[model samples]
Structure formats: C-alpha cells, structure tokens
Target: MSVKSYRQALNEALHQEMARDPHVIVIGEDIAGGAGASGQQDAWGGAFGVTKGLLGAFGPARVRDTPISESAFVGAAVGAAATGLRPVAEIMFVDFLGVCFDQIFNQAAKFRYMFGGKAVTPFVLRATFGAGTRSASQHSQALYPIFTHIPGLKVVIPSSPYDAKGLLTQAIRDNDPVIFLENKLLYDTVGEVPDGPYVIPFGEANILREGSDVTIIAFGRMVHIAMDAANALAKEGIDCTVIDPRTTSPLDEDTILESAEETGRVVIVDEANPRCGMAADVSSIIAEKAFGALKAPIMKVTAPHTPVPYAPNLEAAYLPDATRVAAAARAAFTYGK
Candidate 1:
C-alpha cells in the first residue's frame, strides 16, 4: 500500500492496465501534450495532468493525442473497441459530451444489444466533472446521471484515490462501454492506494460509515460531503451511516435498501440537479422497495435546476456541502418525531 493523489492513482491504473494488455490504448487531446510543438514533448499530460508520464511509457501509438474533435475520436474509440482494442478515450470534461453523445449513447452503448449480444465494446470514456473549480457552466457540470440513464452503458464515479484506481481498472477490463466520471476537485486529494492493480466490482455500494440513526447516500464528490456531514452529525449525537454507490447505473439497490431499512431515514446528496438526478432515483427506489421501513421522508440534498455559475462564491453555494447535508440529515431524523 502507498499514499497517492487521485491524479497519480488514475495515472497508475492506466499505466498498469496498458502494461498488462497491449490492446489497452489511450486517446485524448493533450494527453501526450506538445504533440507538434517545438518545445518538450509529453508536456501537458491532459487538462489536469492525470495522463502525465503515460506518453513516455507507452509511446505515441498506445498513448495517442487526437484533434480537438470529441465526436471523431470517440467514434474512433467505439470502432476500435468493436474490432479488438480496449480504448480509454478521455472526453476532457463531462460537459463536452454534447458533441459526442450519439457516438456514446446511440452507437457504443447499443452495439452489443443491437447486434444480438455479439459485440463487446470494451471502451472507457473518461471525463472530469463537478462544480468546485469555478470553471463555470460549460466545463463543470456533473453529468454522470445522463450516462447512467443509458441501458448498455456503465457509469462509474470514484470518490477517493483508492476507489479511482480500483474502479477504473474494472471499467477498463469490463467487456462493455463504461463512462468513468472523475471529480476534478478530487484530483489532488490523497489517499492510500495499492501498489498494483485491483478491481472494485461495479454495483457494490461501499459503506464508509455505519450508524443506526440515518443513512446518507452520496455520489462522486458528494461522497466526501456526506462523510463530513456524518462526522459533524456524530458530534451532535446524531449517528449516521454513509454509503457511496460507486456505480450509478447498476446501482447497488440492495445495499441502499438495506441501509435505508436499517435506519428508516435517508438523506441523498447529489451534485447534479434535483430533478431526475441520482438522488431522485435513489429516493424513488427506497420509496418503492422499502416504503414500509420509512420512519421519515427521504430528504434529497442537491443543486437547484440551474446552470453552474462562474463566480466562485455562487458556485460554492450552488454545490451541495457538508453543512447542507448535515442539516438535511437532521431534518430526516426529526421529520416524524
């Protein structure tokens, strides 16, 4: 085991996977950096430097830098996956999925089912998401829920460096199209990770904290917020259970339902908009499956249905925080009393 940043863990996962299988290739803009520049090559290593050092190890063939067109490269990745390669294509920001939605949702996601289960699209579409960096509405939307809505696509949102490494390795190895959403705010966050590759199976909800009072379900960066809230609530004698549903699509409904039944109260924290987001989806699930276990109403703490503001203060307020989560949990605790 070794302490590593989320960025480093992702880089290591890609490196290990590429070394393990020659067919695993990386394609994205500025991934190798300084591609045609006069200065040093392999400079940028991606927008946040997550792909740094990969270019030097894998070379231009495996660690490829493509044009700024997301549609073209994402389509190419889908094609490559259908043939034989396991392509890990970085879509830059989750907000940029607009240009390549057809390639992802229509083609890549449907190929296996559309072709009588014969195609194995082992393609990983990686992108940075969340709203903390003040990159404004265009670049900072938490759009994992959109991808999760698709049937054939698997969506992964890793909260910690350890989870990032494990979940990414699983996504790369899985014989299906996976949308791996990384929280940009968590790039520098450090945690203990294994030195070698490991896979955190999809659809398993990780229980970060265990308590009997209430269950706090959170996703992506919101998982950290839920942890902070759980810790604060513990100080107030309001113990809480925190769950990180690592994958949103094949959501660990059993774990969530179990936790919700144990506590009889649920507070879902999601960075996406309140309408039809993961929070809403989880709430609906608990309501439909475990309605009899409820002692209080499910409280959903999420962003308003508006574009992410560019201003730092507004953006901070727009995103869900520990204080908000704690307050929601407290409300859930007191709702029926």
Candidate 2:
C-alpha cells in the first residue's frame, strides 16, 4: 500500500485494468491530449489529466480520442460494449450526460434485460461531479442522483483514494454498466491505496468510525464533510457513526437500516440538490424501514434546489458544510432532552 492522490488512484486503476484486459479500451474527448497535433502528444491526458500516461503505455488504437460529441461517442461506446468490447467512456463533465441520455438509459442500461439475460454491457462511464471548484454552474454539478434514478445503471461515488481504486476496479470487472462518478474537488485529496489492482464488491457500505449517538451517511466529497462533522460532534460528547454507501444503485440498505436502528438518528449529507437526491432516497428508506427505532426526526443536509452558483460566496453557502451537518446531528442527539 502507498499514499496516493485520488487522481493517481484512478489513473492507476485505468492503467492496471487496460493492461490486464486487452479488450478494455478508453474513448473520450482529448483522452490522448494531442492525438493529431504536432506538439507533445498525451499532453492533456484528459480534461483533468487522469488519463495522462495511457497513450504511451497502450497504443493509439486502444487509448482513443473521440471527437467533441457526447451523443456520438457515448452512443458508440454503448454499441462497442454490446459487441464484446469493454469500453471505458469519459464524459469530461457530468453535465454533458443529457446529450447521450438515450444511449445510456435506454440502450446500454437495458441490454441484458432486453436480450433476455444474454447481453453483457461491461462498460464504465467516468464523469467528474460535485461543487467547490469554482467551475461555475455549467461545469459543476453533483448529478449522480440523476443517473442513480435509472433502473439498470449502477452509480458509484468514492470518498477517498482507497475506495476510488477498489470501486473503480470493481466497476471495470462488473458485467453491468457502471456510472463511476469522481468529484472534481477530491482529485487532489490524498489517501493510502493498494499498489496492485483490487476490487471492492458493490452494495457494501463502509461503516467508517462508529459511534453510539448518531449515524451519518454520506457519499462522494460530502463524506469528508460528514466525517468532519462527526469528529466535531465527538468532542462535545455526541458520538456519531459515519457510513459511506459507496455505490448508490446497488445500495447497502441492510447496513444503512442496521446503522439507523442502532443509533436511531440519521443525518444524510448529499452535495446534490435536496429534492429527489440520494439524501431524500435514503431518508425515505430509513423512515419506512427504521421508523420505529427513531429518536429524532431524520435530517437531510443537501444543496438547495437551484443550479450551482458561480460566485465563490454563493457556492460556499450552497454546499452542505461540516457546521450544518454538525448542527443537524446535534439536534438529533439532543432531541427530547
């Protein structure tokens, strides 16, 4: 195991996976940086430099650079996956998903069911999400919830470098189409990740730092925010258990329900909009299943139902910070006292 940044872990995962499987190919805009340019090739690596060294490792055939078209490239990726090629397609930004919604939701997502369990779309859609980078509303949005609503798509949001490598490895190996989301803000965050390739199965929630007072469930970059809140709460005599439900589609309902029942208070933190987001979804699950074991009302700390603001101040106010999360957890912990 070695200390690696989140970006390094993702890059390592792609490198290891492509080396392991020749059939695995990468296609996206500027993936090879300067594919046809006269200057230094593989310069950009990708929009965020996650695919930097891939062009040098694997030739141009496997590490491809597609035109500036999400609909065209994403649709092509769907077809490629259905035809036996395990393609890893990048969307650059999660906001561009609307351009190829049909290919993803209607085509790739339902291939297995549509073909009576014979089809296997072993494809992974990598996109950057979340706020706090000042990338503005257009380039910044935590849109994983939109993908999670789809039936056949598996949504993954890793909080740390360790989870990023393991979950991405698992997504590449899985037969179904996986929507692996990476928060733009987390790319620089550092954590320990295994040296070689490894896979972490889906639907398993990591109960990070257990406590008896409150249960905190978060995903993506919001997990860090929730952990900070949990740590702050601990100092004030309120212990909180932090749970990261790594994958949203194959959600570990059992672990969440168990944790909620154990603590009897849940503070779900999500960076996406409050309405119809993961926070609301988990809130519903706990309310219905673990309603009887409740000590205080479920608190959902999420962004407002508005587009991400471009201004730094507005964006900071829009995000669910540790203070807000701590306040919610404190409310739950001190209910009826």
User: All models: lDDT?
Assistant: 0.93, 0.92
lDDT of 1: 0.93
RMSD, every candidate, angstroms? 1.7, 1.6
The local lDDT score (0 to 100) that residue 254 gets in candidate 2 is: 98
TM-score of each: 0.98, 0.98
Q: Which stretches of candidate 2 lie over 4 Å from their true place?
A: 33-38
What alpha-carbon RMSD in Å does predicted model 2 have with respect to the real structure?
1.6
> In model 2, which residue pairs have backbone atoms overlapping below 3 Å?
none
| Sliding window of 10 residues with minimal summed lDDT for model 2 | 33-42
